[model samples]
Target: MEADEKIEKISSQTLISNSPSKRIRIRPLTKASLVLRGTLVVLVLLTAYTFYTIDVKDVNFVQGMIGTAKNVKVMFLEPHLSHFSFSHALYQVMITLGLAFLTTVFGAIIAVFLSLFAAQNLSSKRVSVVIKGFAAFIRAVPTVLWVLIFAVAAGLGSVAAVIGMTFHSISYLIKAYSESFEELDKGVIEALQASGASWWQIVFQAVIPSSISYMISWTFMRFEINFAVAVAMGAAAGAGGIGFDMFMASSFYYDIREIGAVTYFILVIAILLEVLATQIKKRLKVNI
Candidate 1:
């Protein structure tokens, strides 16, 4: 009788504990919530309307791709295989690589310096605001405009493309580097300062080391962006890179074969850069 009473008491307690409350309440949406929902619905409707009017099927994408493939086959099997020397194509590739290297290196150096001024924790309030504004101004201007400016000032060739890429890349690099620096542990900086380290020493020892992985990742990402810019400006400025060749072929209504070849070359370079960046991230143990 005692054991049964104890079991019944435990079961009753469990049932009581699990029971839901009898109270009921209703919550109404705020004005802000209703406005946000209405805005989102309007935006979705606009997006759908825009998409519907685009006529994406008019070009027959599959047919165009088949045509491109045919051109590739002809270019590879005929004139490219028989008449053209590999050395010519190799030279264009080298030019693109050189341009990319120069712009990325120069831009990264400039960005490192600018980042010091732009970082909120590193610079005075006035300096930080000024630097941020300047960076924003640089970013607001399109690369095409920069290319035009440099082309007129520097007078064409790879020089213009290099300058254009470097100018635009500085803005991107500064923003990325500043953000990375900001993400560093504040406690580490505080400890270093407490130990009587100078600003430079603290930054070099505590901040940079902690943020090196992000720095490298940003640099690689900027390189890819600058490479594309280089290609575009190279063609526009008559810089004799692969882009120049591609543009020339298009201007003369030359066989799509030539255009396809140049495009393939660019695609291959982009793929290689992506693979190399991935490997670097792995080696550095940088988690994105």
Candidate 2:
């Protein structure tokens, strides 16, 4: 019988009287799901209330938008030279890029060694669990917060920025790398073990070869994240960069025009990096 005809039987059965043989089986809603739905409803209500409270004060949305549109000429058409010079903006942007590169490279290096112990397939379950817990703690903290914490010890600058960003980056890489290692061919590992291959030899010849592509892909993804953090740190942590220029323009509303130029530069650089990463990943896959 067709599925459409099948629904008629159930519907007709529901309309008829219940019996021991024909009793409808109703699944009760789980308490967890019920609570989840209730919580979501409460959150939505709170959000709506907050929006109404704030929106009342800014009722002239159209007028505000028109005013902002007029400012676009000063903000985007002609931008103020950041720090009153082109060289300064160039130098700062380079520093931000360098900071991000250093953090990602250092983080990936540290993670490579740590991931061996963190992978349950390679290491004891107890060891992997413990290592993962530590990484989880670090991952739970925001990258910007880590930068600020390290800034207290390292002092505010690129040094603190690199150290903080690398700290979070290591945990990020560890989670990505260990997961990739865990997915390595189980049969290959078993065969290597049967042949009495040492751990180091198996890792280099088997595990590494099998998972290098995933590791590289994860590293590139993390690099992009670190670059964004570096830009934020440039302004927040006094680690001079184009981000600082942008921050300055925002803080001093008179120089809002310069912000447009700084924003455009950042947008271009980000787009270029994304395209470069995609090309590199494609080439890496082809080579593999």
Number of the top lDDT candidate: 2
Each prediction's RMSD over C-alphas, in Å, is: 7.6, 6.3
Across 66-127, the per-residue lDDT of candidate 2 in tens digits comes to 88898887788886674557777777778888888999999999999999899989999999
For candidate 1, give the lDDT of residue 145. 83
Worst lDDT 10-window in candidate 2 = 16-25
Model 2, stretches more than 4 Å misplaced?
Answer: 1-33, 55-59, 69-74, 80-82
Tell me the tens digit of each residue's lDDT in model 1 across 4-75: 999999999877777775333375678998999999999999999998887776688799899878876876
Shift in Å, residue 187, candidate 1? 1.8
Prediction 1 TM-score vs. true: 0.74
Error of 1 at 279 (Å): 0.6
Provide the lDDT at 110 for model 2. 97
Report the Cα lDDT for candidate 1.
0.81
Residue 69 of model 2, lDDT score: 90
